[model samples]
Target: MSSEKQNLKAGESHGQCQEKAEEWMQSTKDTANAAMDKTADATQSAKNAAPENKEQAAGFLQQTGEQVKGMAQGAVDTVKSTLGVGDKK
Candidate 1:
């Protein structure tokens, strides 16, 4: 009788362990799914924002180019003046 009781207890313990393992696996799956969902959402958001970002960046670059061109022209003018070549109308 004692042997039978030991066997039953061991079986029950094994079943409990299996149940816990299954629960843990399920939790891991849920976490993975949530992470995937969040990643997808972030990817979509980035895609949606890309065109606007590109346009803004292009505008900024154009403005920067204009400023640089102006500065270069000013430098050239300064150099010409320093060389006493400023009388050329």
Candidate 2:
């Protein structure tokens, strides 16, 4: 403990040390506030985009379902063709 105190005295004066500590703390606080602001902005953007994203996803799913139905119909038609079941021939 005494060595620590000696080291402190040997380097910066008490006022200088206090000033540096205050500056460091201020800088840390500024960085934290900026991060918090960015997080808040990101959260708000996600909230705003949620409905649009949901609508887009729903549309995509609907298209995929339609494609699947078309593919199934095509497969059934192919089988019928091979069996000569439905064609007028």
Candidate 3:
């Protein structure tokens, strides 16, 4: 082939390569953006769920505290009776 024809062919090949590269880059960017959006949604969901978990934990702690108080009061009453400090009935 003539030198001019060879140069034209080379230019066309370079343009095609550049177009494919740009498309690949765009596709990669879109995939990355979608993954980021999903991650953000998951993070927000976790944040929203935390308050309910905290409330459940607080309720459990309150029940535990009440139980402990009752046990302590019972022990105190028993100790007082053993020491001959019972209230007259």
Candidate 4:
């Protein structure tokens, strides 16, 4: 091939390589940004749910405590009646 033709071809190849590199870099940056955005959203959602979860746990514990107290009282009554120590009326 002629020298001029070879030089032209080399320049064209360099241009194509540069374009492909630019496209790859852009794609990588976009993917990283998307991943960061998803992580931020997840963190925000967890922060928002913490208080609600704590309140629910507290409510459940209170309900369970009340049920346990009732059962204990009922057992005491049963024991008293069995022993004939209950109300003498």
| Clash pairs, model 1 backbone | none
The TM-score leader among the candidates is 1
RMSD of each: 1.1, 5.0, 3.8, 3.1
Clash numbers, per candidate = 0, 0, 0, 0
- CA lDDT of every candidate: 0.98, 0.95, 0.97, 0.98
Give the per-residue lDDT of model 3 (tens digit) for 35-57.
99999999999999999999999
List where candidate 2 sits over 4 angstroms from the true fold. Answer: 1-12, 86-89
**lDDT score for candidate 2 against the true structure:** 0.95
lDDT of 1 at 67: 100
Give the per-residue lDDT digits (tens) of candidate 1, residues 1-85: 9999999999999999999999999999999999999999999999999999999999999999999999999999999999988
Collision pairs in model 2: none
Worst 10 residues of 3 by lDDT: 80-89
Q: Which stretches of candidate 4 lie over 4 Å from their true place?
A: 65-89
